[model samples]
Target: VLVCLILRLSGNVGAAPESALITSLPGFSGAFPSKHYSGYVTIDGKPSPKNLFYYFVSSERNPQLDPVVLWLNGGPGCSSFDGFVYEHGPFNFEVGNSTGTLPVLHLNPYSWSKVSSVIYLDSPAGVGFSYSENTSNYVNGDFQTASDTHTFLLKWFELFPEFVANPFYIAGESYAGIYVPTLASDVALGTKTGAKPIINFKGYMVGNGVSDPKFDGNALVPFAHGMALISDSMFEEAEAACNGNYHEPKDQKCSNILDEIDEALSGLNIYDILEPCFYGSAAKDDERKNTSSLPLSFKQLGATDKPFPVRKRIFGRAWPFHAPVRDGIVPSWPELVKRSGLSVPCMDNTLATIWLNNEAVRKAIHASPEAGEWTLCIDIAYTHDAGSMIKYHLNLTAQGYRALIF
Candidate 1:
């Protein structure tokens, strides 16, 4: 029955080609069958283009007419491949001594591949295995990334024409917050086959996204208080001192309030501070010494024996299993701008501009040529609700796209 189900899910039941089950992780158990493909696409009619790496993970059951999800990790330079290995993919890195490759973790039952065939592409060149000999071609910004991704979709469809009609969704967090919407608008507005656009794009899902800078910054104070990182009084004082301006005069009193919050949350592990140094055995020992929940011999912190030191400490105390802050939510805006070709100082201003305009959302949609017909699906309650983030999602609706924030 399991074999039949797997065959039905993959659409490959006869003799069940062994090629599909080419690899499996020892400790990881799940139903995904992993495969990889590499090819080159001409970006500018060049004779030879850089090779692109793509990983396809299919669900265990016989293939259904599942949607295709293209996952892009922000960094403007970071690899979605890493997101695949660490977060939702069929494999995870096991701890090894010094420099050995650890066994792959099997697919997670909750893996998105189970519902949709997920494609993780290393994009824009210079990231992971995707590379270019022409250094000039490697530097890409938002426009270029969007253009390339659009082209990639068309070319990819040409290669696998069968999946061209499948429902497509673009999903990612953080910077992807920007990428998904921008690309969605572009694809929507673009025409394929000279008259119809090739991509069958549906909706997008973004989490903890950085959409509007002003809203995100302003939201910090309330979010801090809600998380108990700061007192309500402190928030009020900071608001008055800064005159509701959080970005100006980095040395202002409002800055101090945020600093205090940062300091208080520092050692508490509220945010994932990417430091060069790792917390060693001594730090782990100290933390465990006062804890009754863990055994004295517990070595969860430094249990890995990989070739290089495992810098990230995966916490086992909670349901989420990992530190929420470390999950790429907090992005270095300056770094993102530098990579995306937008001016660093202008980022905050750009977000601020979006916040000031009542018609900004409508304008942003019209700005894209591909979005011919669009509509607003803004969840006002979700946007204003303390727990939900509406500002982060407004851009999509502004582009005439439908979105449900809650």
Candidate 2:
């Protein structure tokens, strides 16, 4: 079969077929079966448009009739490329020699594209390649972000109307626990009100998400004890002191016990409890040398020494969003968790980051020349005004929408 990569459209700039379609990739050896499209969808149209960037990969087996799943990476500031490149995209970037060179791309055997079409979106105006000419749009809060995403989907369907009838499912990880449901609810409302470009709204899934802050807190200390990261006596003390309310312990001793729990699990990769933290591995040898249980310090991980050969931090105006110091039970306390869009302990994005930064790769994917360097996450200016999304979940179920929380 004939193959094409970047399809630079020349017709109506607003037309779907012309505007955001990608025809070529930077490092693929030959044209493969699956089709790829990458481009921007303007959420705010015309004068001062707010553009949301997206990467669309169709299923390998059947393009015309497959479930169209939308994937969003959490952090409220993290790029969906985390899902696209590392977790479930068509290719994985191969970081070579630890040199900041153009990383190579290799086909991913378990890419979700094998069964369903996927749209990986970088949202909220300031995240990833998506941006707003009006700086005021950057600091928008939770409901606003969800509203913008709903607008994105409606506009997107207008461009590719074929999948309007396909099984549509929205899925996200981490904080997207809030995003997915909020957006899904919007879609459900649109369906109910007979919105344009009719969407066949279905269920959604949230993996390792932050559903309820209170629920999230209830399990941490118990989970730590179960994992053998803490002693039984410590667990008993925490349970008795906190009276099962770890979020806001009733007494000072309970609060102290919770602090003790934090100390016990101090530097372990909070993302994956079992994995060795690569943070302290300053040099190539350092990464391999300190594989034991001891929590490696930032200095011992060679932080002050200009760092290890792999997993370099892409710090700048782009990609270094952080949780607030007073963040709720889930993100706060675990020191390095979600800082600057940092990947959980073992995720390696060196290849993806390098490849995406390459000039040719950027042009092939139709990246905006003006948008700054590609980073893991953006230092997004967002406010969490929604507090809890339990109401959104209840609302979805009330509207007959199915849901999955993992």
Candidate 3:
């Protein structure tokens, strides 16, 4: 009954993918205020194409005039549903009464879609419901990811030509700090090159983004001291021992000091130190002490030997998950999986996992069952080939592209 009402309200919007139009969601019985669509946008078309999944919500206020914003998540392998389900998508989901039941959904008053249409995209093959038949597509890098996303934008516009004239913006956090600027630069370039189905490319915004290695790698030390997580004496000792460079140690003394800092931060949630870092009641003392979450790409913090149980929330302020790399390339999964002695994706995504994997939810969202089970994070052999994002930033900004780095 609700589905019929929603479909009636939406009427015959013919430009967008008709099959992808979602009339009603599983948990929300109320009629949708805005039209929602979810489907796959193929990149590098045909034969062995890379399909990137996207969930698009038209603006609740004004779909035609409002801006179209594309949102991505970091991890190089994390799904953009991280933002949709947890942060700013149109729904606020509550975990089911029991373990296996589906979560209930309520409208999010603060959803970005209230003012502007938002596209939550699962980019780079192998992340979320996005996939490719070619095995080699999964072994991708930053440059290829950006390029593929650009292709996605072009094709997505073709599908929703009504939004082609809407002002478009790219935004994301974490590893997407790398994703946003590179993709923005491509869109800006496309505008000049007479790319068909031209979008009104405007500006981009990144929150707590990882911009440069030198800056990102060196951020946590000062952050820790300012937050009182590290004692004044320890901060001073670290400052003197490492010569203010905690990201890389010059001597064993510096290495020992960084290890001590990791131990000090082991109990607190690195994403948000103010929050309690929960430990399972049965967790052993050594296991509790062994847990430490650090920045994603900046793993100079240290390593841990054991993994402990903790309920991690993705809404934490900082990007926490120490991903160790070698020769500047983020090593393939299972090789450099331990993040600062802690396991990767230290957050608890039980609700998202259950809800997204639900057959009814998948059917409503137009995600194919063949896309397989959905996990918050997947392992992709991601390479940081784009180098420092500074160049991309400079190029885009110089071309009159607006940028906001918060």
lDDT of 2 by residue, 1-406 (tens): 0111111222212334755566767777757558788888887733478889889998897866678999998876778887887677898566455556565667878889999999999977777788777766777666888888999999898888666667789999877887898889888888779887677677899987767667776777778789888899998988788788886677789878877776565545555455344544344553344233345443254333322322332211111111111232222211244453322333344566677788998888888866678877655556666667788889888877778988
Best by TM-score: 3
**Candidate 3 vs. true structure, TM-score:** 0.83
Score every model by TM-score.
0.61, 0.80, 0.83
- Residues 1-406, model 3: lDDT tens digits: 3532443456524589789999988888888889999999877834488889999999999887799999999876788998998888898887565556787888988899999999999987888999888767787777888889999999998898778777899999877888999899888888889887677899999987778766676777888889887899998998899887766678899888888887676545555455444334544443344344444323433333322222334423223222122233233223343543444434556678888998888989989776789987776677777778888898888989899998
Model 2 misplacement above 4 A: 1-19, 45-47, 250-252, 277-348
| Two-way lDDT contest, 2 vs 3, winner | 3
Task: Report the number of the highest-lDDT candidate.
Answer: 3
Q: Provide backbone clash counts, one per model.
A: 27, 9, 2
Which residue segments of model 1 deviate by more than 4 Å?
1-42, 45-50, 62-64, 97-99, 191-197, 249-251, 267-406
> What does the lDDT come to for candidate 2?
0.69
The Cα error of candidate 1 at residue 22, in Å, is 7.1
Specify the poorest-scoring 10-residue window by lDDT in model 3. Answer: 317-326
